[model samples]
Target: MAGDGTIEKVSIIISKGSLEGVYPGLIMANGARAEGIEANLFFTFFGLDAIHERRWERVRLATVGNPGLHLPTWVGALPGVSALMTRYMARRMDRLDIPPVPEFVEMIADTGAGLYACQASVDLFGYRREDFIGQVKDIITVGEFYDLAAGGQIIFT
Candidate 1:
């Protein structure tokens, strides 16, 4: 679509904290960047965890409520299911050569994509700007994000 010269940029909003939740946004941002499209990743609410240094390495798949998994919500609540699912995912990604979360963030940042933390979510959760990963360009408000993303497609994941 970008070759048409109409869609030159993209803004992605990531609102979930799980491993699966975080990947789609990063993957899309990376894909856009690879396509020579400018991309901005807006991390809000639980999504902020994806860019937090201490938690990024620990982020795991959220299995409990995922209807797509076919396992009932309570089934995913079994003691080790989440961990198992996360490991399986990690292995699957390894086979596909997908970098781990932190590395993936760094890779995207290295590609010139903008990484941002949502100010309201940061304030609501009592997180200081310094708590974010170095790749984050800045912590921004939703209005600021809108201004930055003007004329671009917006994708929420």
Candidate 2:
């Protein structure tokens, strides 16, 4: 439980390896921080792409195998399709007044939220420390992350 103070601790577990999943975790963590909550995000599996320097710029929208995806799987699999779709979606989201992922990430980092990439996932996926973005706090073990989550409201996004 959080202390009886002004700040509230919120732990968020990001497990999905998709562009859609990554943004929500970041947005929520940042939003919580904006409200003076102590936000912490644990990135696991494909979600690590959001933190990886090499992969962050190349993060693609999941058009295939995503039940909520409006585009067909074949279209998503087509070369340049995902990129085009991502751009289109970004434009559409902009029209709807939604901020881009990079901006959201900057906002989250600016709010001083703790951002951790899963060490086990990094090793399993062959990612190095140099591969991650500069804002990442550390590559933490699952046990360590859970230790932080204990007694806090944990949400999987």
Candidate 3:
């Protein structure tokens, strides 16, 4: 374990599986690697979408059911509202100079953070190997992920 109780290796589990949740995991993993901590990120459930090659390009904000959205959760839940909200958020992010999700993923990958897509989730979602983005190291089972996460600082972000 590390002096601060952070282990020499850190495993991050990104389960939220949305555009909003994706950045924190990527950013944190990269930051951990920058600090000389070995880092790995497992993308499961909705997060698997972030690593999907076909769908990644279409990644959008989750307006509906997202309590953190600028609009009221009810408004976001309304049909067509989510799309508009997603577009609005994208525009706002652009104005704020925030990079897109794919760009952020690229940046994280550049830092040598290990990226994995959950094999079980992928199969459940009917995603083939070719559907995932290029940065994924491999498709791993939850048990395999646990093996890596064990004895390390495991964080679910």
Q: Per-residue CA lDDT of candidate 2, range 16-68, in tens? A: 75668887887789778878888899989988877777666666678876667
- Order candidates by TM-score, high to low: 1, 2, 3
**Could you tell me the lDDT of residue 41 within candidate 3?**
91
Worst 10 residues of 1 by lDDT: 1-10
lDDT of each: 0.93, 0.80, 0.81
TM-score of 1: 0.95
What C-alpha root-mean-square deviation, in Å, does candidate 3 show against the real structure? 2.2
Q: Worst ten-residue run, lDDT, model 3? A: 64-73
Task: Report the number of the highest-TM-score candidate.
Answer: 1
- The lDDT, on a scale of 0 to 1, for candidate 2 is 0.80
Q: Candidate 3 residues 1-157, lDDT tens each?
A: 9668765888998877566777688778877888888898999988887788877766777777676765677787788876776687778888977677888777777888888999889889888888888899999999999997887888887
Question: With candidate 1 superimposed using the best TM-score fit, by how many Å does residue 96's alpha carbon deviate from the native?
Answer: 0.8
Which residue pairs of candidate 3 clash?
17-46, 17-47
**Given candidate 2, what's the lDDT at residue 10?**
87
